[model samples]
Target: MAGSTFVIAGQNAIRRFKPKDHIFETLATHVDQEMLNKPNDLAFDALGNLVFTCPGNSRQEPTGYICALQPDGRVTKIPEHMYFPNGLAFAPFEDALIIAETYRHRLWKGHWNASALKWEDAHPWVEVGGPIGPDGMAFDQAGNLYVAIFDQAQIKQINPQGEIREVYPLSGRRPTNCAFDLSGKHGLIVTEAERGEILSLSVDQPGFPLFRGNNGWK
Candidate 1:
């Protein structure tokens, strides 16, 4: 939970739900005064700026992009021509951001410029080759990344050195996203699409604590 508001991304807009008021407020519809093609997934930087992937409708073409919502209510886009940018997360170490390009079956990890509030140098860090759908991911305290493979019916653990450490097969076919129980007792709580189920897997260590940021939604 980043900040007090529940942030949602989809339907060409980024909305926030304030539990206290029980209302959904639109944070961004059009970035830079233009309609968002299709906002897919979102995450927060070390500074709390809201970042998301927008693949639009061009799944077969390289037209996907990324955007960020500033704390002061501003939206900025990081333009790129990639297959399909699906999910993203801020690296717990090295002030980096890792993004999933689903169609290409690749993950790009890049360092960011804190002062400029932008990505500096990002390149292909690893390949999740199989069905071309690396959906959601999270990092453990031991520096392993658990990625829910969309069509592979499994979860992969990527080590800190950017290698496939292990693979945990799932009963559900299409695992979409995952997160760890804050208390580290429930292991990894994963959501799936094919069977519409929530699965939990025991692991070696607890996940790195997620940030409750006040940067973007300040």
Candidate 2:
């Protein structure tokens, strides 16, 4: 939840809803009047820019893109072209972006370019698994990245040094997404798509803090 409202990826749109509000608001639909590909997962940069992945479809070439809901209420592409871009998250200490090129089985690292509103050094950082690659991801307060390995029935924990620290086994096979609870109660929570269950695990530390939302978050 960001900025007292919940924003979610909807069909060809970014939608927002508030508690007690019966109608959901459409935040974005297109960029430069061109219809957008269906938005997949969502993220927020350190600057509080609402970011999301739009992977059109399965294709031989990388055609998916990442977009941001800017402060001006405009939809713009942060970085373009990827192979079925899936889950994404911003690093806590910097404006750097960590993305999952799911189909390519690669995890990418990039730095934000505020001037151009894009990423620099947008290249593969490491290789995880094959065809069914990493899905939704999150970072802990300690800066370690936790990635859900689809079809692998595990969440791989990789330290900042790119070293694998742990392979957290799960009951379900397909884990779609994961998040760290800001509250002191729950540590890490995951969504298992295969059996339709929500799972949680205790952690040593809480999740890294995130910018509240895109609009007037500062």
Candidate 3:
């Protein structure tokens, strides 16, 4: 029963939506007019506020920022300045938000407190891919960060203590997003490019595709 809102950087306006009906709510059109135009991924904080990447349109977009949609429908920007920030997650144990920097090939950390919105203690948390673009991310029950790497065509597993534990490469050229099965024994992966299909991989084994689809909405 979560509410919906669409927010971009520099835009104070909030657009709400209903997923079930696939329609916009009353405040669907009001948006911030002063923020950056291009935003990347969308995530949520512990309080359920919407958070997303405001990468703008250039790699030079100064110190990337993450926008939080407040309960009042106002979007607040947190300037983090992590290179091309993408996927994001809150590390409960650390009380901080972990963000993946696509162009920097690393992860950045920020405190979760309300006052942490401004970039102050922001710093690199973990490095990934020797030279690959890290995109979508997810954390396993063990707190292992799984990164969908582009160009390299692999999923990198970074352990809780900041270690490159494993690499799961796919036969497909590019893997976009990923989700673990309830049992944690299998994974479902989405490939943004290549036109048609999701690559399913077994956790026990790596670099193999179990099944694929025709890129259908169904």
Candidate 4:
């Protein structure tokens, strides 16, 4: 997985792609529909377990949940019901996993238990303001969290203390997610879902490099 890219499809499936040869292979399929109706964002824990968010229908109820796919093909649902789990990320120090609850307009944190292979101490990390929902998140080297505000077409920079420090307006509409490029020029790349485009912007800070194990999926 070191040289390959992983992609999540709409039909509850995950795929791996080799860019050099343009070859794609189905990595996992038929993910539990009840627990993972809509797999939104994914991240890896310190132990390399696949953590993903399933933001179920927001109009119905708070049915969304966070799930972890173990290396041995077992799926464990984190014991929490979120309104709309959209984005996911692990702390730079691998201390906690951060989640964005879109409909609730807040970020949540959960600590990992390596021995038990579970998450604990789940709590609210930050309360995002405004009518727009937080969709995706990325961290800078200085531990600043960048959140993509979907409805407002804006991005918010939140400090480690969970305070909004700055907001940047974007030309794209309905921005779905964002990621910072650690290599090359160190720019922020955002996905304009509605417009079907990708936007790149230069930032003052570089992104924190994510830890990748020898297995490569992380």
Name the candidate that leads on TM-score: 1
Which regions in candidate 4 have their CA more than 4 angstroms from the true location?
19-23, 30-35, 184-186, 215-218
Candidate 2 local Cα displacement, residue 109, angstroms: 0.2
After TM-score superposition, the amount by which residue 218's alpha carbon in candidate 4 deviates from its true location, in angstroms, is: 11
Worst 10 residues of 4 by lDDT: 27-36
lDDT of 3 by residue, 1-218 (tens): 34433433234334556677787544322235664445666655555566677665446565666776554556677764556777777653455667878887788876776544443477788877636577777666566777788777788887778788998877765676675565545564555565456776666422221112212111
lDDT at 193, model 4: 79
lDDT of 4 by residue, 87-190 (tens): 88887765777888888778888787754667789888888764757888888888888888887888889887778999888987577888988884749999
| lDDT measured at residue 132 in model 1 versus the true structure, 0 to 100 | 56
Per-model clash counts, in order, read 0, 0, 12, 0
Give me the displacement of residue 136 in model 4, in angstroms.
0.9
TM-score of each: 0.93, 0.91, 0.75, 0.87
Q: What local lDDT does model 4 show for residue 196?
A: 88
Q: Least lDDT summed over 10 consecutive residues: which range in candidate 1?
A: 1-10
Q: Candidate 2 regions off by >4 Å?
A: 1-3, 212-218
Answer with 1 or 3, whichever has the higher TM-score: 1
